[model samples]
Target: MGPAISLLPALAIAFSASQSSAQTPAPYSPAKSGFDFPIYTNHPPGNTLPNDPVRRGATTPPLHPDETRKLIQVPPGFEVRVFASEPMVVNPVAMTWDERGRLWVLELYEYPRGAKPGEKPRDRIKILEDTDADGVADKVTVFADGFNLATGLALGNGGVYLGAAPNLYFLQDTNAPAGSGAGALQKANKQTVLLTGFGLEDRHELLNGFAWGPDGWLYMTHGVFTRSKVRDAHDPDGFGVQMDAALARFHPRTKKFEVFADGTSNPWGVDWNERGDAFVSACVIQHLFHMAPGGQYNRQGGTWANPFGYVGDLPTKGLPAVVDWRHYRAAHAGICIYQGDQFPPEWRGLVMLGNIHQNALNCDRLTPLGSTYRAEKESTLLGPAGEALRAKTGATIKQGEEWRHVGPGNFLVSGDPWFRPVSVQTGPDGALWVMDWCDRYPC
Candidate 1:
């Protein structure tokens, strides 16, 4: 693990700005007429709004798993199949793989509004397995239940780390017999509140994006608007680290917590390159950032945490966004550095991100820069490219003709407007596994 660090610098930097300068931007108000929704008007120049009328009206009823699969479009030699669907898996917001190749899915049944007082928490963690070497998940086990608004999940250190607002929990199965793989999770008998005091003002902005760093520390991200004073559970009244809209890490064995980096709005996904450099996908502002320990990035709104900390008008002034341009709505989540062998050789090492607002999965080419890296937009992996063509040419492209007009690099696209790929990962089988929220409204 890395050296013990304090958030004193981050706190000072975050709050040093004047009160007037630190005020957050006005919230988005709903539309009064038509299908126009409020957009993030605070974005810097060069950022344009998406087609709101079409996007807002694009909502279609949820398609059956088979029909939805038919609407999906992938590059030649690739196919999209149903892994798990409703009644089997619902509201899968996050996913991770264990050492034994079991997929752990975090289902947020109690979203928008968390469970009411005295009510049983509905969020759950389930383990899914394709026991017969089939593409679809045939086995599902509820590893844990009774969680309220849990958004992040990771399995390691003989237990699972869960990110539910106001607390980070660690659960272990005391009923497991000697030397069992995931049998330990088959019965979540013991629960430990590792750390406490996360914010829950915005249900969507809870503590999330749990990841393990190369140095063996468990890393997580916190969103803006929600201020957190995180302290060890055993010593809640003792010294705590103040965090807001930042990246933080914890050492499980040592029970040590540190703010790794600060300044990004609602960062829901984070991953590392082969060189151990960290990248994050955020929402509303710039969608991508190269995160480093002790670094402070430009905010979506409000003044810099530290006024004297490098001030510049350009968005790329400080620890810059990996990509300069913005995509549709810039609401990005779930990122992966492609290192799997399933994709073509040209696809290796690229950055994959889910554009929830655009209803697509996008790719970025990572090129080395001095000490950092630059992300250039690549082809749309899974999106409505065919629809774009139809709009331009006034010629309807049939379902099978979607990939014909697009480049080979555009891997997958779905005609279904509800194809919200919220999270993407390289599965154990070397294929890309996508967690489609399968909903019209991402938030």
Candidate 2:
């Protein structure tokens, strides 16, 4: 519940420069030979004319679930199966399980390829269920729709919270009857846009990554190139905060939003350990931050010197990452602290992270290092049938079809390019469930 007193007058707000609709970046030109892909292009600096071709055809069909399952490599004694895929569920960007064991999936049909400036929103949040106790989802219900590039999802406070960039919406279905379907949810659901003014320049980097903290506040992430000036919906002209590449905390009942940490570069995944200590996985940087209140981490576009005059020294600026990732661009996505009893006892408290670009799942052990923490990165997912794509992992390769890159240092890298893991979580049954944003590339 919200505080009795008005907390608005004491808070400070930062309003960044506003961009007109004309300033929006142009959509991908599918007409060009090299531009037919659905994902965005991140051209390496100084290589403007390079010709990197797409492996799949311009109109490549989605992979069937049976064929897709063979391409993935799970740990020994662990079996990976297709819980759901396209035609049944498409473009699953994010997912969270409700208390009743229902999986809520966020579908972003308009990603990398976004809706035109004036185009209406075309996204939906579907509730998936497995009624017969089968491993796969057998039912789907569209709980809400008509959202502009909705990228984040979390369940708390009697509703589903959605991050649609420039707007955060809460959809509550108070009057829905038992076993409600899409139509019933649509009729009973009430849509409330709680806050607005998030960055939208880059489609991937908006107000995303929603997770409820142990402290009862909702934690969210903003990526680099974002310019957010979020204000209270109740008081439109009142105070807000200018947030860029930072962790934001919003109290649902209080309607209070504040910056949890000051600096970060496109944080994509966040979760907590058994001890309630926060850990985060950042994109491109390939590092993990152990977050604390008021702590600052790496900021992409800012310049500051440390005590030793080291400019842009991230370790000095804030808490250093538990693991630096050492320049391997894994394109980290959703992360989770293994809390289920289904996995081996050794994996009980480890942090599991998904690297979408590298097609691998990684685990790390956080060991206390005085006041801060340090991590010992464990094994990575190995490519199937003993063929690892990266040479650095050759030594850790094994002989079986399920051979994972066993590591004191090696990673598990699935040789399959279609294995794009966007979110990794401990499923209701205790097996780790991975959401494959299965596409030619991530947008």
Candidate 3:
């Protein structure tokens, strides 16, 4: 057992934002003719793209699990024990270890670096049971199936929320009684389709990443799948024409979703500091093009819409929203808010994030500077087994990258751009748990 602390006390104390209400949106005009398959400003499709290390090393060498042994990298001194290994289903997108200490892993259909199109789904909502209290998982069972690739999942408040393909779904995890066999996880109940209608263009930019922020409101991001179906155009607060909204915070009581932020590409993770402000993973837009440089999609700048800057305060119509979030190329996945009593006050409110494709995990300690509080990367905790990867890799990284297709305009040329996700959670044992493709944990 661990020390007890309030999860959303900040929402009640110091939480003063405008009131939000939910209403059924009326119909809107049809989409423009050119709206069939989306094309970025400049994408040169077809021809071959420059080769990337991972792409060229399509015959990549052996990836050792012990790559992070170098670099005095250690997180908060919390004793970490691998709760499970070879987590089975590709990259373990997100994980939630409930109050009862039950662990849930949302498996992404495709994994490793740069996920492509053909390998879209490999299925199963892997639920693990450690019944014996021995760190390792004693039982593994399918919690749910038939998913187009689930990216995030968490157990909070009273239910379990999953980052399903098109939207977020809430399932009642009344895992069977203690004596009940592994069969308990197999059956999923109290299924509620929390939100719907995320444009399922290719894979990458679907609306995903849901978690209860420190403020207590349900938060979700409306990834970058341009506007397939706009809910409300008459609504004055709408961003503009030709784009699906970006992010939003939902009020269960009111049953309405208010746009939290806009003008960004697909964002991977959403986490808030102890004070309740937000931070986005800001995933780039070109991953889908999956090609080399000089192609149409490969523009002069690197993934412009959301580069190195994590725009914050995502807001919708007067509500406090994501003001900004930093940008990282293919920064797909992993983020969480840690407020454990075990760590010193200095470490209490930090936001931790994981990157699947980048093969790294990072953290941004929240600090209050003068008038406002901002996030700064405290450490790049675990990076890809660089030296080892290089030692084993066949070729030296190629210099310049070129591509065949010139794209519809400028931004959609090379890479296939599939989505990558990293789910973060604070376990019952008072330790932070992160699951990527190869490893995860904290005791």
Compose the digit string of candidate 3's lDDT tens values, residues 313-397.
3322111212234423345454666776554565566665554443334455555645445555443332222322244444333
Q: Model 1 clash pairs? A: 13-305, 382-412
TM-score for candidate 2, please give it.
0.79
Superposition error at 124 for model 3 (Å)? 2.8
Which 10 successive residues of model 1 have the least lDDT summed? 5-14
For model 3 the local lDDT of residue 212 reads 69
lDDT ranking, best first? 1, 2, 3
Provide the clashing-pair count of each candidate structure: 2, 7, 67
Question: Which candidate gets the maximum lDDT versus the true structure?
Answer: 1
Return the lDDT, model 1, position 139.
89
lDDT of each model, Cα atoms only? 0.68, 0.62, 0.43
Across 236-340, the per-residue lDDT of candidate 2 in tens digits comes to: 896678788777889989889998876667788678888888887777664678888877666665532222323455535555677765423446777778788
- The all-Cα superposition gives candidate 2 an RMSD in Å to the true structure of 11.8
Candidate 2 backbone overlaps, count: 7
lDDT of 1 by residue, 376-396 (tens): 766544345555455545777
Model 3, TM vs. native: 0.58
On lDDT, the stronger of 1 and 2 is: 1
List candidate 3 stretches off by more than 4 Å: 1-46, 54-59, 62-80, 87-89, 110-122, 156-159, 172-186, 189-194, 226-245, 285-332, 342-345, 356-358, 369-371, 379-421, 438-443
